[model samples]
Target: MTDTTKPRIVITYCTQCQWLLRAGWMAQELLSTFGADIGEVALVPGTGGVFQIDCNDVVIWERQRDDGFPDVKTLKQRVRDQLEPGRDLGHIDRA
Candidate 1:
C-alpha cells in the first residue's frame, strides 16, 4: 500500500459519548474546508471519552487532554496547519 501526499484525516470519537454525529459532522466539515487538497476523511469508533482528530497519524485534537471538542473553525485550522500550512481559511483564520 502507498500513502499519498495529501493528508488523510481520521476522526476517532467515543461511542460512549454518542458522538457519531459529531464525528461525521467534523468529517464533512474537514472535507468541505479542504476540498481536493486533502486525501480522505475517515471516522473511527472509540471509547473512554476519546475524541481525537488525526491527520496522517498525527494527532490534532484529543478531548480529555484538550478538555473539550473543538469548534469547527478551530478544528479546520488545526488541520490546515498540519496539511496545508499555506491554506487560507479566510474568515476562519482570524483568532
Candidate 2:
C-alpha cells in the first residue's frame, strides 16, 4: 500500500456473482474517469477476486470482502473528493 509506483483503484463485486464482471466494470469506470492516466484495466481470473489495472505498471485492486459491489458513482465521487489527484488510489484504505 505504501508503494507509490502502483496503480490505485478499488474494485467491488457481489458475493454471489462473478468477480470478473465486477472487475470489468471497475476497469470501465476507471477508464471513464482517469482515461489516459490509466493505461488499462483487466480482471485477473481466479485470483481471489483481484482486478489488475495497467498504467505505469501493474496495480492490483481487490474487491470488498463481503457480498455486494460498491456503487461506482459513489466510489468515483469518493476518490475524487477524498483522495488527492495524481496520488495512487491504492494507498487509500476503505473502511
- TM-scores vs. true structure, each candidate: 0.90, 0.44
Error of 1 at 30 (Å): 0.5
lDDT over C-alpha atoms for residue 69 of model 1: 94
Q: Candidate 1, residues 1-95: lDDT per residue as tens digits?
A: 32487778999999998999999999998888787888788899988888999999999999888999999988988988997789788999776
lDDT of each: 0.88, 0.48
Worst 10 residues of 2 by lDDT: 53-62
Q: What are the per-residue Cα lDDT tens digits for candidate 2 across 1-95?
A: 23445345544333344666666776787667766543334344544443333233322222343233456654554445433444545434344
Off by over 4 Å in 1: 1-3
- Clashing residue pairs found in predicted model 2: 8-90
Candidate 1 lDDT (Cα, whole model)?
Answer: 0.88
Candidate with top lDDT is 1
